[model samples]
Target: MVQDTRELNRTAVLTELLRIRPASRKQLAAASGISAATVTRAVEQLIAQDLVVEAAELVSVQRGRRAVLLDVVADRSLVVGVDLGASNTRVMLADMVGSPIERREIATPIEADATALADWLASVIDEIAGERRDRVESVYIGLPGAVGRDGSTISNAPNLPQLEEPGFLDSVRARSGRPVRADNDANLALLGEQHFGAARNAPTAVMVTIGAGLGAGLSIDGRILRGSHGVIGEFGQLPAGPLGTRLELMVTGPGIMRLASEAGVHLDSPADLFTPDASEPVRSLRAHFDQALLIVLTAATVSCEPEVIVLGGGIAKSLARDLARYEAMLEHHLGAAPRLTASELGDFAGATGAVVAALHEVYRGLGVDERAFGDLPVAVPASA
Candidate 1:
């Protein structure tokens, strides 16, 4: 039982470290509720495995020597983060710090070839590598559809039907020569925001992404909430509203076009709904947008009263000026409103989250490379 408890303690400490700042053994122990001696042993194992490293020396006021601070070694591994959105595909290469080193984006057709897409991704990865292609360790993709728990199968995505077929991930991995990780797009968006955006410290938050479809991502007590079958937070299925369709129709590209047409305002795409000019059609579109915002706010807040709610995706840009309107609508419905804000990461949150997950995978895969930490100091201060 003690051995099991110690192993559990190690897992807890590692999670806490990833959530917050890197620390020395003593600090990690305090933050993780683990013993310092056990933390020391864990640190040694982590360092030897190249998962952690001596970051720098912490200065001490006492006459004794300073202690070395431990941190996750980011440069030792790399991963590719891909976002397969409804209308576009974004790819980014990042290290463990979640910093992008190389990034690319391209418009995608509703129906695309999986093989061609995989080959395109492989070429993008090669271009990003330039000369040091071997440095890339793995690939991670955020699918707009529901991802199977195995991280291999894509169940269904209306906008991304090309990926519905099997062996897509296999093909990509086979072409790129690296393991692949796949996740729900909204879930990854929340991960990215949790790690690098406005909700970095929030214990509970919700990210609402509106585009071709309306989806949400939730974090409860700093942990991702993936529901049964790993497809939760799907707000698109909400009851059809005044527009004679689901609330998604109010904001999606097709919805925008449909609504605009009904309003007798001809438009090419939903993106045109946000023209800065104040023509009669534009005014009507803005008014329609306000009503749609209320519908979205009611649906999102009534279900889960999160501490913060962030709106993201292509259509979210138009709502930036109307945050107060949405907040008011939510407050009126729920009787209390979570702090509503626009997403800080814009359209790249999903890609960033994919990379973050991939980084963790690479670190876990390369266990205890003895050559990576030869003779490195691994001491920790008692106070911190």
Candidate 2:
């Protein structure tokens, strides 16, 4: 109806066509409610920018008239995914299709603050870009905290002490010089799974991350559910155990160790929980994990009734041998069992999730490209 509305509709058409199926001018016009002339003009602009290209010539069977197939040029754009944790930070460079080209992981020293961490992440991305930095579209970071409505970290995360300071998002953005998207790691993980892993076709699902901390990410009708406060599926510190033990501290490595030690057994490491002798500490750890998983499944099912439950994070892999145990526990609580599977991405899930989120944002035109950083201080020495 209006000029701006027409432009917006054109972009929406391009995005929807690229998302569903690559189509020609006629198809674009039919799908987008725009005129065929408008579709051709918009498609020409996109092709000039190398964002879309003619894939193949299709001919109708009736008259055999050739029609060129238009498809998104996926490699023309790229995004950087950053996963920041209390102990580590990882960076991944990926194409618009969410396929990674390069990845790097580095340990975050014991007490590094947010500023220092963002600097390191930016440097890693710069190095990854090298000379082809102009093509990178955006940077997305996944962290273990609630992302506030205004893109700041809420005061809920005690683990990230540096985030307590005011203006966290602005500080990170200023240093990185790239638009940054910060989301809960679990939310990103669920997205990564849906886009690239076990839940590809699942309409509704839940991804449970069992690690140093417990968290859940939810997807409903194929879209991630970020609650009003952006704390949709934060499962940490919830009363998860029979005696009201905090869920996160009870399901993690430290949690298992604590529970075992309190049961008068010594579990020096997570590996020790799998002893052949069936030690009391090992048994106690198993029981605690089972109970915690039951609570998690119960809560998750009652809320989302997901088609599948994906187990992700460090602890999930470690507990692979005891998957049956966890499932049995879940069954005891919730009569019918949902399909459960372990994450295939392993330690890379968060980083991969970040990449997926970044690509989605790029396609939606919601974030700035990394190479679009005009004149910020080259945080990393270029000559390195």
Candidate 3:
């Protein structure tokens, strides 16, 4: 038990140093709320582990003890984050301090060739981490479907069925040699917003991603609200158009084109379908899209009462053009609505969030309290 307590103190101090950075034992104690003697003992253990190091010193010209500053050994601590979209796969290498070191994106392989995809992903992971590969403690992967709560199985990914194939995920894990983690891509995007983008500090937030498909990710009370069965925030099935048609049928990027095609407009791109001087058919399609979006937005508003709703993915720019108008419409119906906003991380939110989750996992292994992250909305002194 004494050893356990000592380990816990080390985790708190190390976590605080990673966050505030290059701080003295005094500062770590103050920021992390750990006792000064405990912080000192923790620092000693961390330095012995080579996870923490002393760099530079703070001192006055007068006769006084110099304060040696401590920081995480960034190069010695690394993680990988992968955003596996149906069209593109993005990977990032992040240091323990949450700074992204490198990123690479490539066309995602077709669903028929799971082995090929895993091979390419492993090579990319190898290329990005290179000499730093050994330092990577965890690898995070985000997929565009419902990931089980335990993250061992993927039950609802229609586009990338290969992901659920026997031995496919295990192949990536075996090749990478690091523990691989997975979650819904939409959930990772929401995680990105809370950590480093639009939804930062929002107590409750909802994110709607409109790409090849429509998806939602929700955060309540600063915790990712993955539902009981790992099936939550499935916003695409919301009622839209007539009583039967789902919102995803008219609100996704492909769905938008379908709407214009059904209207006989024959538009080449979704952006073209929403011009100010659009033909009547195009206008009608846009109206249908608007109504569909409003339905999803209103549902998010009423159900979660999010502090903010962040729009993301390929179609977010198109939605942002008339965000205020949509906000007004939602207010008219619901009597109140949270602020509507666009994702600040844009296309990289999922990958970035994947890395953040990986870092959190690493911290937990170091004996840091999970509640420290749960209190991210109020407790952590840094952006994290």
Candidate 4:
């Protein structure tokens, strides 16, 4: 093992214990690549700060020996994650261990300007954070459109153009009274799945969403890839036909409805168009959808060869009932398919992912990279 740096010993120890707990100083040292003596000093500091606790004693590897186990105090700090969409907004409060403590939902303040909407969101954060304000670690928000690298600036958004107004992201941060970060909702969806949903532990993955509009999110080597303009996942314009048809026009909710109308039927939703007793033309909607889906899969497989491809959002959930058929479609076209699956977190995936991102951002300097928090489940405390 290398000698601990003058500044990094404590960060390393805490990061290791946060990722995996109930371990002795020896274990922390080994896992964090720090020395035992340094780990002991770091543990003492953490305990003094009430972040880590000496919970129990376990048998040591050495004969007739015992070691004190250190664990993170579950509620020592909390993070807030927000998913602001075109129609609705979801907010979650989670502890340091990524367990969601409480959640709330409401329709988006579409009538208000973007800055005003951000103010409302900040007020919601304040309400939920009430007594825990002092213990709140950070807040991360997910937007329905692309956000600038600064984490607050909105570049372009069709569904919620108001958010594109300058100072929208800054208003949330200023009024929220905590460290804040924000990004595209689709990217957050992929982040949620990689950490807590269908794409768990995958090195590379892609998530495509179908609802009010179409969007995509990508992850490569465990980091969200936003591209030069943070527009990499906007798949609405992806060429879905040989001549020149838009993917959004072929496979999204609107597209499906359009196909139904072309067949002389009015569809309340995709559910109406996909029923068993449907018209022959409406039933043929599947073929068109499959072709557009194939285009998405082919682009993903050929570009980065993702380890998994997850379909999410309202329409994707509706299509999940036929998941096997989609999986088979991938294998048939791409030779070897990235695992395709439905989102496990459902409506909360984006909010949950915001928590995950905020947690990582908190410890990024402590050696817990976004990818390092892999496969760790967000669970409720036994006392709760």
Candidate 5:
């Protein structure tokens, strides 16, 4: 029990250091709420483990002495985050500080079976890692479907048929020689928002992604609420329309295109919806899209009562100029609604979330309480 207490204190100190690096021992103690002696001890152990380093000392104004500032050893370890979308797969290599060191995107093997997709991912990992592959402590893959309770099986993914195969995740693990973590892409996007974007300090939030298909990621009390079968945010499957069409069929990119075509607009891409000179048919399409979005947001609002709702994905970003109008409509219908905002991380939100998830696993492996580092903002490189 004494050892556990020490470990918790140590984790608290380390977490504070990571959140606000280059801090004096006194600052760390104050920020972490740990005793000065405990902070000193933890800092010493972390320094010895090569996980933390002391930078230039800060000269005290009142005294002649200088205080050392400690920070995490950014390059001591690395992690990989993969966002596997229906059309493309993005891989990011990040240092311990969550700064992207390298990033690449490849066409997703949508037509490939499980084994083929696994092999492709293995090759991509090898290419990205090069000589530093072994330094990768963990890898996280975000899929655009409902991940099973165990985090491997794909219970439902209509866009990516490859995930339906048994042992798909196991095969990826076997090929990569590293345990691969998986989650719904939307869930990862929400995780990304919490760690790196708009929802950083929000206790409860939801991200509704309108891309090739509609999905949501919910955070309740600062924790993701993955349902029993990991389909908690499969909002796309909700029935809508007079003929009982799935909600996604009316709001997603492809759905919008189809609707526009049916209305005689003949839109070639969803981006055309944002064209300045939209035709009458296109105007009708927007109205339909907004109505469908309202249904999804209303359900999310009444059920989760999120503090904020972040909208993401290609279609959402393209129509970002009109989000406020939708928010107002929602308020009119529900009396009060969560603040609606666009995702700052854009398409990279899922990949960033995967990196955060892998970092959490790394903390767990090091016997550190992952919760100790609450609301630590991810360090996104300016170039990335």
Candidate 6:
């Protein structure tokens, strides 16, 4: 019991350091609500473990002596984040403080074979890590599908069918030679927003990713909601207008292309539909998109009452110039729309969120209760 209490105090101090590093022992004690003597002992143990280091001293104005500031030795450990997309795979390495150190992107495997994908991922991990690959303590993978509750299997991934293969996660773990975790892409995107993007400090937020497909990431009180089957925000599968049962057929990039063709506007690609020189028929498709988006946003707002709804993915990113129109349409439908903003993280949102998830696992392994630390005040770099 005594050892447990001491470890708890140490974790408290360490968590505080992560939040506001380079803090004096006095500040850590005050921020953690632990007694000064306990803070001193915990700080000494952390320093001895090489997890914490003393930085420049802060001269006390009231007292003659200077106080040494403590900070986490971020370079001592690292985590890897991987985003397995329909077309590409992105891998990144980040330090314990969540700062990305390196990143790599490659074409996804052509074959829908688990072994092939694992080999490709392992190659990417090696390429990113270069010499420090072994420094990676854990790995988190974001997939564009419903991850099983155990984070070992993926289902309902039409774009990347290889993930459905049995023992896929095990194969990746064996090849990568590290602990591996997997989650739905949209869910991780929302977590990325919470930890390092626009939704920072937001208690509740929803991210609607509209691209070749449509999906959402819902968070309430800073916790992501993954349903029993790990498929909570598969909004694209929801029924909509006479077109089809899937809402993606109406609002996504491919949906826009289909709608444009039906309207007698033949475009080479869905991206062309957003060009300024788009035909009248293609321009008119915006109304359909507006209605479709309103439907999704309304459902999200009514159900979760999120503080903010973030629009992401290729289609939504292109519509940033027309945000006013989208907002007006949403207001007209819902009477009052939640705060809406475009995703600032672009395509890297899922990857960054995967890093955050890996960091959480690292914290747990170190006996740090992340919940007790509240939100950290780390400034996310404008360019990641």
lDDT of each: 0.71, 0.71, 0.81, 0.77, 0.84, 0.81
Each candidate structure's count of clashing pairs: 1, 1, 0, 0, 0, 0
Per-residue lDDT for 73-185 in model 3, tens only?
A: 87777889899898998888887767788888888877548888888777888888999898999899888888776666776676678777666677888888889988888
Q: Number of the top candidate by lDDT?
A: 5
Report clash pairs, candidate 2.
Answer: 137-369
Candidate 1 local lDDT, 1-384, one digit each (tens): 987765566555555555454566767877877888888877776677676788766755347857667777766766788888777888787765555677777776555488887677666666776665677787788888877777677764777777777887778778877777788898888777776676666758888888877778877776677755666776676665764666777777767777788888877667677776768867877787777667766666666668888888878877788788678777777688888888777778888777766765664554322221111112110110
**TM-scores for all predictions:** 0.79, 0.82, 0.92, 0.89, 0.94, 0.94
lDDT, candidate 2, at 244: 75
How does candidate 5 score on lDDT?
Answer: 0.84
Error of 5 at 319 (Å): 1.6
Preferred candidate (TM-score higher): 2 or 3: 3
Please give, for residues 35-130, the per-residue lDDT of candidate 6 as tens digits. Answer: 999999999999999999988666474558778878899888898888888777777788888878887777787575778888878778777877
TM-score of 3: 0.92
Candidate 3's C-alpha runs over 4 A off are 33-35, 57-66, 374-384
Give the backbone clash total of model 4.
0
* Model 2: per-residue Cα lDDT over 1-384, one tens digit each: 686765665575565455545577778887767888878877786778777788876746346776877877767888888777766777788776555777877876637676775566667777877775788878888877778767775555656767656777677777667788788888887777776677767869999987766788988887778866777777765775667767777777777777777877776776676665676647767766766767777788777889888898777877677667666767777787677888866667778778877766675573222332111111111110
Worst 10 residues of 3 by lDDT: 375-384
Tell me model 1's lDDT, rounded to 2 decimals. 0.71
User: Poorest 10 consecutive residues of model 4 by lDDT?
Assistant: 375-384
Per-residue lDDT tens digits for candidate 5, residues 184-260, read 99999899888778787887999899888788999898898897689897878888764998898998888888887
Cα deviation of 365, candidate 5, in Å: 1.4
